[model samples]
Target chain A: MSGLTPREWLGLEATHNPHRWYLPVIPRLSVREIFLFGGAGLAAATTALEETTERPVVWATAQYLDFAKVGETMDLDVHVSVSGRYTTQARVIGRVGDREIITVNAALGRRELDLTETWPTPPDVRSPDACRPRGYDYDQDSLGKHLDQRFAPTTGKKLGGPTGHGPGRLCVWTKPPDGVGNSAATLAVFGDFVPMGISNVASQPVGSNSLDNTLRIIDVRPSEWYLLDIEAGGIANGFGHGQLRIWDDQGNLQAIASQSVVVRDRLKR
Target chain B: MSGLTPREWLGLEATHNPHRWYLPVIPRLSVREIFLFGGAGLAAATTALEETTERPVVWATAQYLDFAKVGETMDLDVHVSVSGRYTTQARVIGRVGDREIITVNAALGRRELDLTETWPTPPDVRSPDACRPRGYDYDQDSLGKHLDQRFAPTTGKKLGGPTGHGPGRLCVWTKPPDGVGNSAATLAVFGDFVPMGISNVASQPVGSNSLDNTLRIIDVRPSEWYLLDIEAGGIANGFGHGQLRIWDDQGNLQAIASQSVVVRDRLKR
Candidate 1:
C-alpha cells in the first residue's frame, strides 16, 4: 500500500479545523518530525484563531512525545481552549492512533501596545555573503546544503579545545533552500543548529540531533535577517544546556526559546 | 556619587559569588525586574560554565522568578542542582544585596551530528526590499535609529481589510548599527526584535518593544543579516502571541523565537 507523505498527512485538516493528523509515524522522522508537525499544528491554530477571532499568533510552547515512523498513521488534534478578543489559547496532541506522540499548548493574541522589559542588542558583523562559512565534516550532508549561513567575524572558524569549546555568542544566517518565513521551515532551521554549539567548542566536530525540542518566538519581522547569539555552560559528559537570543534587524526583540537535547555519541561530521 | 552597572555588580565578591548573588531585594525594579535580574544571574552563570565545562549550550529553559532594575546592583548566586555527562543543571538567583530579585534553572549539553526530520518550506516570495518602509505607532525613540529596517514591498503601503494577515509565513532581511556585537552590543541586537512579530503582520503598522526580556544564545555570531520569519496569533484582551524564525540568507534556519505583545487595538492605515 502507498503510504502517505508527510505533507499528505499534514493536509488532512483545513487551516481552520482543530484536529490532529495521525499517520504512520515515520521512524526516520523521529521527534524531529514532531517538531515540524507541532509547528504545523501551531500554524493551523494561529491561522484559525486569528481569522475566527480576528487576532494573530503571539506565543506558543510545546514538547515532543516520542519517535514516529512513516508506515503508521498517527492522530493529530488541536483544541481552542480559550478564545478572547485580544488573545486565544490552544491544546494540541499527536498520537499513533492510540499511543501519543506529542502535546502542545499555544497562546494567540490580538495586537496591543505596552511598555514592558526585554533584552538588549548583541555585537555586529558583516552581511551573510561577505562572511566566511565554517565548513564542517557534516557540511556535505542534508544538514549543510539546506542552509544559507553567515558567521560573525569575532568567532573562531571551526570547533576547538575546552574552555567549553568556545565562548558564548554565535550568529549564523540559515534557512532551507526556501529562504525564511514558513513556520515548519523555521523548525527545520532551528533543529539544524542543535549541534553547532557543541561542534564549535569541541576539539573536533560532533553531531547530535534534538531528542525533544522547545521554541519561543519573539515578535520579529518575517522578512528581515535574524541573529541568533547562543551561549552554553557545564558539559561534564555528553549532555549539557545552552541559551539563545533570537533577534531581527528591526530591533523588535523576539521571544526566548530553550530546550533539552540528547547527545548521540557515535555521530561525527 | 557612585554608579554601578549590571557588570559591576557581577564583579563584586558579594554579588559575583556564584554562591551568593540573590540575597537582598530592592523594590523599585519590581518583582518583574527581579526576574530580569535573575536573567542577569544566569547570564553570568552561562559565561562561567562556558569557560569551565566547555560544552556547547544545547538546551536551556529558564522561568522568571522576579524582576530587577537598572540603577541598583544585583547579585548572582548559583548551585548545581543536577550533574551528568550529557547535561549539567544549575539554579541561580539575582538579588538586591539583601533581597532576592529572581531565580532560574538551566540545562547544558554536548554537541554532535544531527539526525533526520523535514518540515514545510515557504512558498517563495519576492525579496523584502520589494516592500516599502512603513511607519509604526510603537515609540521606538530609543530603538528607532538603533534599528536598521526596510519593510516588505507593502510595509507602509496601503492595503485593505485586516483579512489578509497570514501566518502563511513572511520574510525580512535585518541588520543593526555597526559595532553592536560584543560587550553590551550583543544584547542590544537581540533585544531589538522583541515586538517584531506584531509589526510584521499588523495592517496599520504597529510595533512592540522588548520588556521583561530573556535570551539564550545557543550559537555565537558576530553581525550579519539574519532572516526573520514570524507568525502572530492568540489575540485577546488586546494582547497577542507570536513566534519568530531566524535564518541566514542562504535559507538555513538558525534560530527560533516567540513573544507576548499587547495588541491594544487595530486601526486602519
Candidate 2:
C-alpha cells in the first residue's frame, strides 16, 4: 500500500485557493497513453468537490465536453451553488488551458434516518478467485492496467470474441491497486465500464466515447473485490445507454451508475 | 390543442439576450402550489439549451440546488461549453433572484448511423384503455393535475395504501394534456416520477425531495399515452434511488431516466 488516498494516486494537486485544483494527465491516467480516461477526469472533479465542500459525495454527474490528452494539465474550478445544513450542491468545471474538458455537478453530505434497505439482489456468480483474469486487446500502460479484473462465469466469451445474441449484460469482478480504498472516487473510475459492456452487447469490436456518466452512491464498504453488474439498455441513433450496479464481495450494494455514450466502431488491428 | 410548443406551455419566454430565458413559476408549474415541480424546472432548462444550441438533446441531467416557489421568476442562463461538428455540450443555470435553483448539463445533436436497436422489452400489461385512472390523495392545482395518468395492471395498490412486500416496481400510463407533443423537453417533464415510485417501494406514506434527475432520450415518437415503468433501486442513509423507462403505446422506447431523492415521510391527514 502506498498509504495514499485515491486523489493522491491520481496525482491531484491542491492549490492555495480552496476552490481550485490541478491534475496532470499522466500515462497511468490516460487511455492507451492517448487521452485522459473519462472516469479519471470525473474522479478528479469529484475529489475536488468533496475537498471543497468538506462532505462526502452523495451523487455526481459528469458531462464530457472534450479530451485532455496525456501530458496536459487540467485545472478544475469548484463552485458551491448551495450549502445547506445537511447537503451541499456544487459543480466543477475542468479545462486544459482554454478548452473545456469536463463539467461535473454533485451533491454531498448525508442525513440521519432510521430507514435503510436495498431491493435489488446481487447476481449469483463465482468468487473472483475462481474466475480467470480478464484480457485486454490493447496491451498498453493506461488506467485499465492498474486494476485487476476477472470475468464471472456468466461472461461466456472474452471481449472481441464471437457470441450469441442475448441480453446485453456482463459481470466482472474488479480490484483496484492496494492504496485505492473503497472511496467514491475509486468507484467513479469503475463506473466508466459501461462502454465496455456495450461492446459485449453489440457482439462486435465496438466501444463508445461517453457523453455523460451519472453516479449515485448508496453505501461504500471496504471489500477485496467489487462486482460490476453491467447491463446495456439499448443502442439507437448512434448512441448507447447502460447502467451498472456495483456490489462488494460481501454482497453489499455500494453504488449505481448510468451513462450514455457515443457509439463508435473500433478497427481490429 | 393550444397549438403552443411544450416550451410555450411551460411559459418559458425568450429574453433580449440569446443566452437568457425566463420562466414564471405559476401554480400550474408547481407542486401543490408550494414549489416549482422538479421536472418542470429541468424542462425549462432543456428548452433554453435547445433554443440556444439549436440541437436536440441527447441527454440532460439536472441537480436540484434550491427550490423556486410559486410566484417566483426563474432566470435561466445558457452556456455552451463545446460545440463540436455533430454534438454540443452545454449547461443551464437557473436562479430565482440571487438563489441558484438548478444546474443542468446536457449534450445535444445527432449523428448519422444505421445501427439501431432496443434490447429491453416493455412489460406485459393491459392497454391504457383497460386501466383505471390513477387516484391522487391530494387534489390540487399543480402539474400533476395537468397529466392524465392510469395505473397499469401490475400496480395493484394506489399510493398511501397497503401493499405486499414485493419488488419495488410500478407502471403507469401517462398522457399530458394536448399540445405537449413528444419533444425532449416533454420527456424531461415526465422523467421526474422517480420520487413518486419510491413511495410505492416503501409501502408507506412517503415521498422525496429530488436531489438530481438524469434523462437520456432514445427515440421520441408521439403517442396518446406513454407508459412510465419505474423501479426503486434502494434507499439508504436518508436517500432513495430509482430509474424509469418511458415507452410509447406503440412499444417504442422513448427515454430513460434515473434519479436520487432525499426520502421524506409524508403525514397522513
**Which candidate gets the maximum lDDT versus the true structure?**
2
lDDT, each prediction: 0.43, 0.85
**DockQ, all models:** 0.09, 0.74
B26: Cα error in model 1, Å: 24
Predicted candidate 2 versus true structure: per-residue lDDT over B1-269, tens digit per residue: 43668677899999899899999999988899999999999999988998989888889999998899999999999999888888888899899998889999998888766678777777766788888887668867789888888777643333421122237777888997667778887899889999878887785567688999899999989888998888788888878998899999988989999999988767632
**Any runs in candidate 2 off by more than 4 Å, and if so which?**
A1-3, A155-166, A267-269, B1-3, B155-166, B267-269
Q: Which TM-score value belongs to model 2?
A: 0.93
lDDT of 1 by residue, B82-173 (tens): 45655655545456656544343345554333422212132233455464443556442332334355443323333321212243234555
Model 1 lDDT per residue over A148-265, tens place: 5667553334442222123533566543334335343243235335356654554334444443344455453453455555544323234433445455545454544444455454
Error of 1 at B138 (Å): 34
- The 10-residue segment with the lowest total lDDT in model 2 chain B: B156-165
**B226 Cα displacement, candidate 1 (Å):** 35
Q: Could you give the interface RMSD of candidate 2 in angstroms?
A: 1.0
Model 1 misplaced regions, further than 4 Å: A1-17, A21-55, A70-74, A114-118, A132-144, A155-166, A179-192, A203-206, A209-212, A236-238, A249-255, A264-269, B1-269
**For candidate 1 chain B, which ten residues in a row score worst on lDDT?**
B115-124
Q: Chain A only: give the TM-score of model 2.
A: 0.93
